[model samples]
Target: MQLKSSEETASKAELIWAITGILVVFFAAMLSMNIVITALPVIVSELGGTQIQYAWVLTGLLLANASSTLVWGKLADMYSKKVLFQAANIIFFTSSLAAGLAPNMEFLIGARVVQGIGMGGLISLAMAIMGSIVSPRERGKYAGYIGAVLAASTAAGPLIGGVTVDTLGWRWCFWVGIPLCLAALVVVHTKLKVPRYGTPGKIDVFGVILLVTGCSALLIWLSFAGTPEFFEWISLPSALLIGGALAVIAVFVIVERRIANPIVRLGMLRDRTTILAAISSAAIAPALFSCLLFLAQYFQIGRGFTPTEAGLMLLPVVGGNMLGALITGRLITRYGKWKIYIVTGAIVMSTAMFGLGFVLGADTPIWLIIGALIVVGLGFGAQMQNLMLVVQNTVPVTRVGQASSLIAFCRILGGAAGTAILGSVMAVAVGTSAVAPTNGTNPVYAEATGTLFLIAACITSVAVFTNIAIKEVPLRTTV
Candidate 1:
């Protein structure tokens, strides 16, 4: 008995460390997603790329990441997760190094496509791995750790990206995280262990192709839609391409429902909690992401702040997010009430969105901007991972991969759609503005960007009620 107890403690300790270490790298990997945004305009200007091309740089990564998420999740269910996780980090590290050495924006964008593949694996697999280790009752503690890492990464991304851009040049931003990735690899290799589980299903190759092709088309259209006159949504070629993509997507959904082992597992969508979480997550994407894009631009373009200064201005959002994560974790642990946080977060987020929309203008007060961002941060921190937890806790351990991936997919889709639609609106709004001696006033861009925020606020207001309608289930006691 004594010997058995000793081994059990040792195993648990190793598992905890492994989970913690892998998550750190996961955080670092995700940091790159947004880190490049603050520096992208400068990178594009230096590389002489057009704005539409610049947006593609972002879209390529988003679509690849979004589509691959389901693939990784399905693989985790079929193979050794530790092996897959390590493989992903290796890919991420190699891609970052390649990105750092890229000759131009085109090369950098290609490197990011590789980077996105690895990133998609990290987020989805990490959640699935956690489902294997911790019981639902105790998962919140570890989830808190994950939450902290996420908030920290998001908060620190722009700051780190800005500093790297200013001092070592933007390439170093890619190079800097390589060592951290290696560190995570070592920790997982040595410390992580789980009982082997036999694969039960075959890969759905057809379903994978269909999902990828459909999402890829949407992202391609979004990337080019507003940057050039020829890329307009109603334009003949654009309409044909987008129409074709939708038809493909509709076919893919049909395929998913028929597959014995579907890549996405549409059966989960029947769950009230899962469906609501996924939809709300998708809807909230436009508001949060578009804000991030425009605010970063506002700080840099409108306010004339350096990348570093813009990063600093974002601290309130980051700080508030951390607080919200902590409180929400405890609330779930103690009360088992998940929807309240979602409702509250949406309401708070909507209020902040409205504040930022109409209140912001040239020469607006920085303090007020920071205050509004704090609300946005609180809503995000409180709401983001909790939704994942809600879905994760509700499903069986075997289904964690699909469920987690689905929620993540919603968030990714939301972000891509938000950036695309809101970006077009902003561009048009900017075009209608007065020409200036310094920076020509783009009135239409400002108006459209502002309108997007109002739309985001409205969405969140609706989310508040949708959240309220969700019924809470008891947290799972075991995986």
Candidate 2:
């Protein structure tokens, strides 16, 4: 891939430094979400938490993160990206302080919600800023670097969390990200700059209220569905509420179409590139997130690995992600059509999911599990960065913030829904079967989790087909 005029014109040192600074923040923010995976058992035990409550520990943050991404993205468009980025860091840092000092699960969960807001902003806005500074043709290289950071943070999150919980207690999972974020905040404040589109339009207030309420309700229902035994597949009340939520979403879309300053531009969905990227995000999110939740459980509960040991055992997944991101970035630049990689990635990821489903059990071989994980990670890294690039490239420069936000929004929502649905599946699967243990450390849980992954593989295979549906336009000779 050839460098853009802007990139070629940049002093190599300056470009490297900027990329490094952004990635540092990216790593910290990304790591904070999953770092607590291995620490869950200890945290729950100490806090006197129930299994349902423990699930919320994750769902709460994911919900908050998903809900606020579009809001933050809009703000970034209306205000200075640099200032908003710094403020988000401060918010995350302050929340970390609260989390570190939390004596109970409620306090920790509350702080995580706050922390997630900042995270939601940081991830999307950073990409918005990056798109502004780098030409579309040259953005792949920088995105590749960001993708590597993402993989490292995700892969290492549990590892770091395990070490922290064992050595310094679970609080450091939140606290550790605080100081690292400071450096990212400072770097953005000092070095990055793009002109602000000052207060461009009023926020679509009605749309915001409806969409958040609608999505939150849907997510809440999914999260609690099986645990409380709320409703069966044929239950009348459940069907009505879920159907009503769908209705509200339909009305919300209509209202969004009428609003000038919508939360997400309805028109953007018409763009094939943006649509495909968003669809792809929605498909893969559940597969990735649910795996994290179940895999940790499998290792610690089923395989008799300690939290720290489980974290260490998953290094192959992280390492593969780092390599995949680098390779995808270069290939996108060199080849230009992004769909082939996305399709290949989805296929590879689906294969990994199937493998995980089959081989997962109390007595599963470590080598096979690790190999499957590596394949999954490679597929994840290969596809993640390019989705945002596809959307950003498809839209005009003025809509970059909106496009970035939509991409982030889709992925986070996918993640939240994934966690809820798959988590529910695991709960119900284990509950109904004779396999699940009364003590949570049951071989039944492993089989149920693997079954959930099989479902994920089917879903990802659908995404692979959607990837082929995308039409890649030739890059503009000049923007």
On TM-score, the candidate that comes out on top is: 2
Residue 118, model 1, lDDT: 91
TM-score of structure candidate 2: 0.92
Best by lDDT: 2
Indicate the residue-level lDDT of 11 in model 2: 62
Clashing pairs in 2: 435-444
* Stretches of model 2 off by over 4 angstroms after superposition: 1-14, 197-199, 432-441, 476-479
In angstroms, the error of model 2 at 239 is 3.4
Instruction: Give the TM-score of each candidate.
Output: 0.92, 0.92
Give the root-mean-square deviation of each candidate in angstroms: 3.6, 3.2
